[model samples]
Target: MPHDDDHVPRRRARSVFVDITPLRESPAFAKLWTGTAVAQIGAQVTIVAVGLHVYALTESTLAVSFVALWALGPMILAGFVGGALADTYDRRRVALVTAIVAWVSISVMATIAFLDVSVTWPYYALAAVNAAAATILGATRGAILPRLLSPQLLPAAAALSGITMGLAITVGPAVAGVLVASVGFPWTYLLDAVLFTGAFLGILSLPTLTPDGPRRALGLDSVLESLRFLRHAPNVRATFVWDLIAMILGSPRVVFPAAGALVLGGGPITVGILTAAFAVGALLSGLFSGPLGAVRLQGRAVTLAVAAFGACTALFGVVLLGTGLIVGPGAPGEPVVPAIVLACIALAGTGAADNVSAVFRTTILQTAAPDDVRGRMQGLFYVVVAGGPRIGDLVAGGLATLIALWAPPLIGGILILGIMLVLVRTARGFMRYDAHAPTP
Candidate 1:
């Protein structure tokens, strides 16, 4: 009895770390994960480079934020259309084609940068194209995961995906910062173009994945079906709404460039560190995600995680406010070491909380939605995931123009907490949601 008891506790302890069984059990998943992990780093670099480049040119926070705004419309349309196509066609094919298109777009971006094109419009147009293609690829790839792994291992898969994202952001932005400061913008963009080839390999290695149900034509009817399903599925809808609340109110990324230049004063390097801080938190959380897989009350987990995210974001805002008060406004050449450290700590906390929310949210969506409509659902998921932050960028940039730089996050964080509290309390179904008996 003593030996058995000790074994049980030991097993429980081990379970608290990330489960690697999914990687070992699914070779295809392993390839996809590895390839994506590498590719995303490049993607992150480009993301930071673009913001820095735009800000360098226009010297406006709103201009940097508009990068996301430019891509938002195309992203939404592509997400819906891609989801329908994923249902209608082989998911592997859809992912592969889109990956190619995205890769090409990145190359075009690099070419423009390489040729020393002074025009900014080409950058925006190409970025929109890249965002649209990526949205489609993301939707298709998300839907394909279930086909690769068993239902029981979905949580592990989600956890692993979190780790991938964590690694990407943690390394990508930091690298972009150093590269942009050292080699200039074209080289930074070119690196992304080179790294993007990994995605092609990942998609090519995957086996064909088709929808389990009868083939649905790609059009308005299919899109309407997904929307109709979402309308009735309060739990799933709540997840979407809750994420939007958290992202729109809590995201402070738009202000990072300004914060680095004017508030914290380390220039691109400081901006990179600030961006990487959040990813570091996420990476740590994912590394120890063993306990998360065992969580049955995912709805509650999501709520708690998002609440933490809001609180941390608010703290970050406070740090920024404090720094602004100490330094006053206008670009400072010297760095505020203490304030930067505090802000990074807060951002890291926010990242950890956001990753936790994401793991649960993704698991809920994949498990709750039926296989037949999974593609469409994943498409919607892409929209919320991609569009929410863009919307936040707009809000943050616009608010900063009127108020202090730190106001958006401070005000937004409070709104997130309040809104989420009301949303969770009223949605009794979500609070009581059980993973084993997922309802969508």
Candidate 2:
């Protein structure tokens, strides 16, 4: 492990802005980043638009949860299988194929909307297909990244990834709201299909990246090997546990549709703003992430950041609770300016804190794992990243349906705070973990 003092000199020279060293040193990384950014923006648009569309059709939060529920199984399967494939084959080809699959899925979704399909099953099925493809693409891309940059630059690269995500959610949802409101679902889905072509440019430009060690057949054993590796790898495993807690307990995105419709109002626009506010906060954090690169005790930083995330989520719940008591539910399509502002502020806080946690967690995983198992490791990471939120969606939706709309986030956030406190006490080794050593 590098001592805290080792970073002081570098810290002094670092700017307040996010370091662009990864981009400057590697042209391939830059192109890949830019292309992925463009494609991810479109993906976010579809995500937001889908939630709004589902809510409009059913007028039920539980129904919106079903969208995620439908996709969960496929996502999990794809993540494991994709990870195995990434290890056994050319990563560039795997990514390209997955991208094509995702593109076709989105195109089909657009066509269904254009045909004025009233049933929700078609949308749900298409979403599952898209989700599966996206999981593979994400896993392959993560494996490809380490090959493109030096070990020291991984933190900056993760920060850049955060910026990509930030821009995607920020711009995409905001655009989706306007486009959906004006041009309707067909056009919104169509636009996503159009923007998805950007992913191809990135994958196509990449050189072939085969796994470094002995290649094995793609099967259950291949997936199990990655799982077995995690059993002995406490540091890497710790990151996954922390992220699952943060995402499953603290993530509040599922309730946005309900909040917009029943509580905060302004319909899709309010939903967009609420979602975008989180991304805006993430964007600002990435912009100012230079100082974070100097931190040696990365594990401690991740814990602290997730704690902040829980607090902010709780704050958001409080805002919703207060708004319900005072302002009450307004007419559909009406904007509640004060409530929206407060909620955005709270959501943005969660976003900022979550972004910080993500940067370190990603850096740790990328640095600790060997190239041979990195794909499978990233695949499991994808499962947590994709599955945790789906479970959160189910929890938020089910609780909001059974109790008050504000109850799920309020309860979940409190649970996260309690669990994290307990975790930090018991997991002493994880707390003292250092970035320089990169142990797993």
**Top TM-score: which candidate number?**
1
TM values, all candidates: 0.89, 0.88
Candidate 1, lDDT over the whole model: 0.87
Residue-level lDDT tens digits of model 1 in 1-440: 37677799889888888999899999998989888888888998998899888888889877876788899899999989989989899999999989989999899888888888876788888889998998899888889998888877888888889998899877888799899999999999999999988888778899888889898877899999999999998888878988998888887898998899999999878987898899899998888998887789899989989988888888888988888888886877699999899999989999899989988998888888888888888899888988888778789988888998899888888777776677577767899989988988
Error of 2 at 167 (Å): 1.3
Every candidate's lDDT: 0.87, 0.88
Runs with alpha carbons beyond 4 Å of true place in candidate 1: 1-14, 51-66, 112-116, 180-187, 258-269, 322-334, 401-403
TM-score for predicted model 1 compared with the true structure: 0.89
Per-residue lDDT over 210-306 for candidate 2, one digit per residue giving the tens place of the 0 to 100 score? 8999879989999989999999999999899999888878767878888888888888778868977998999999988888888888888888898
Prediction 2 TM-score vs. true: 0.88
**Candidate 2 residue runs with Cα over 4 Å from true position:** 1-14, 49-66, 111-121, 181-186, 257-269, 324-339, 398-403
